[model samples]
Target: MSSPTSIAPAARLSDVHVAFDGVDVVCGVDLHVAPGELAAIAGPNGAGKSTLLEVLAGTRSPRRGQRAVPGAVAFVPQRAAIPPRLPVTVRDVVAVGAWGRLGPWRRADASAHAAVARSLSRMEITELASSPYASLSGGQQQRTLLAQGLARQADLLLLDEPTTGLDADSSRRIRSVLREEADRGVAVVCVSHDAPLLEAADRVVRLEAGRVVGAPRT
Candidate 1:
């Protein structure tokens, strides 16, 4: 495992601050995800969990502080935003994760094919490879979306409510895959209110009223 000081952070928020219309949503938080670490951000609805995620993903600039994240950051939004009704199959959707490197052509080499297959299998969605994306159930769609993010094998992975609507078995599979990704040196920061996920994480950061209160005792 790489130490926080030794390995450059996949994403780092230094004294970050965020607000909306004169109201403070997040304030003065310093967070960093080192290589090979799985960190969980847990907070209530108004605690700015998703806001921080957007900051790290570069979708939103902090009101104050610096945002440093890898160029290959993969941000998987909640399930409702993930399921695509396009005519593409699950395989096609997952394969798109590699498009950043493989280009838009379908005639990718064997290595690219293997990568897509591996990602699907990791999320236990390999059997749905041929199923149309819109045809899968909600849980199945979530799994497929996860496969797409995992396929990126990005330096940083940010997910919001990743396990929402998943069954116990499905959630376990997803968590296991994320742990494995961290083992392989991907910095993973997941925003979730689920207790099981927080317990399983390598570290948990709790927030209240948009400010980090303290680390959870668990």
Candidate 2:
């Protein structure tokens, strides 16, 4: 049940422009991501990489442009608002990914549980399935967020600095998960400073001062 865009670019931004107040962040940039491709948004701090991702996520509407980001998009933001001592468990958090089909109660069926379990294992957080979401460390929480994203079965995934709190092993695992997703025809666009992750991307896009200044990936 895919749309025409499935054959088109998974995401397409034409003459995209984003600004905060009087300052322009993303200016007249045209970018496209095909299905089964992994593209990395690379730049130094203040390069508007995250802002661009927000635009792609539909959280920030460009002041002017045409956006063609496909459906079934999953976004794992850099920082999430987590309440301390919440009663929700790791499995509950990851199950959010299937909410579109399973509903909030997660009473779908055994397949839903299997999907949740698989994502937990992929993120190496199966042992924490019963653990409280608020009880996990920053790295652990990051991994959980990633696992949640993986369980979504999204056609397009937008991740912002997904490995911020990860160690070498964790980072490697995350990269592997992203690669597997792209291989499964998921278009992955991640903003990262992690060297290995960027190296593993199918294409690399460079941004500077809010404009795509280099790279054929975009």
Candidate 3:
């Protein structure tokens, strides 16, 4: 196995800092995730884990620092971030990941549909494709979101609390899927407190008061 430092970075944050209303959330933290690596961010609730993730996702610009990420990035936010009672099916939600490649006016082509189908199968949610996304359990919703991220075929995959509050089996499945994604050369980064996920990570970055305190390996 290649060391994380040996591989070129798929995403990088240099002296990154984020603030909301003049209060800093992420403070001068540098991080880089290599392709085919699973990196987990762990910290207390207000430690700026999610804020740092948003910086890497390029959804939130840092007040002072640099971010380098690929154009093809897939971000799976916490379930609560998704609007409740959306009038869409599981397949429909997953299919939307392809929209970046197909512009606003273009319809999904054959290959795009194939990617959605493959993602659904990979996440073991093909059976739930026709199910209403809002009606599914928390675990099911998480799986659906993972499938959507997979469908994007992105270079960087960022997730927030993927296995939080999940049952044993669901958590195990999600962790395994994350490893599989890394093995397929996708840089996988997740903000999580899940022990199993952290234990399985190639690198675990711990943040305290918006700073990286340690980067320990299992």
Candidate 4:
């Protein structure tokens, strides 16, 4: 983890717009996330937080505006689609983060294995590294997904309602990890309704009807 020092911006969106089925989801939203900063997005249900995150992740193309995402962007969706009967272990799931950088026909190498171990340790899930991924509790599963994201060495992390299904303790643990990441020069953007979790952010942006309703402030 890098020290909490001044760093460059990891992502910037200028007049970004996104529409789904001819319905605007994000309208002319301008946002910037600097390295080592944690920015929280809060809004009512159907405020388009998830849609904006998907656009930022490059998974959903924007309808307009210039968007720049530096380095790798890791996104943990609200509900990760994990196979209920897959024969994968926790460590194996984390190693999937390296798939994008792997060569064709290549398997997990020593470096990838080491990264998986380190990510699990950082998420405090080393003890569950060998557990069947589907057998873990919801909170544990969320932690494993977070480890997968961390293993990718992502410069920008976009979490969509990560604490939705988590208990108080689990939510706190996850928020602590996110804060630690922000301190390490990783831009963190979390879309959540959790009031307590918002305190970890340096700024908060409120969205409504696919547009920013007010100036983002601390």
RMSD of each: 2.3, 3.2, 1.4, 2.6
Q: In order, what lDDT does every prediction score?
A: 0.83, 0.85, 0.89, 0.84
Pairs clashing in candidate 3?
A: none
Off by over 4 Å in 4: 1-7, 101-107
Candidate 1 lDDT tens digits, 110-141: 87788899988888888999998888887788
Clashing pairs in 2: none
TM-score of model 3 vs. true structure = 0.95
Measured by TM-score, how close is model 4 to the native structure?
0.91
Per-candidate TM-scores read 0.90, 0.91, 0.95, 0.91
* Ranking, lDDT, top scorer first: 3, 2, 4, 1
The best candidate by TM-score is 3
lDDT of 2 by residue, 133-186 (tens): 998887888899988888887889999998876787778888999999988889
Better of 1 and 2 by lDDT: 2
**Alpha carbon lDDT at 163, candidate 4:** 91
Report how far off residue 192 is in candidate 4 (Å).
0.5
- In candidate 2, position 68 carries an lDDT of 91
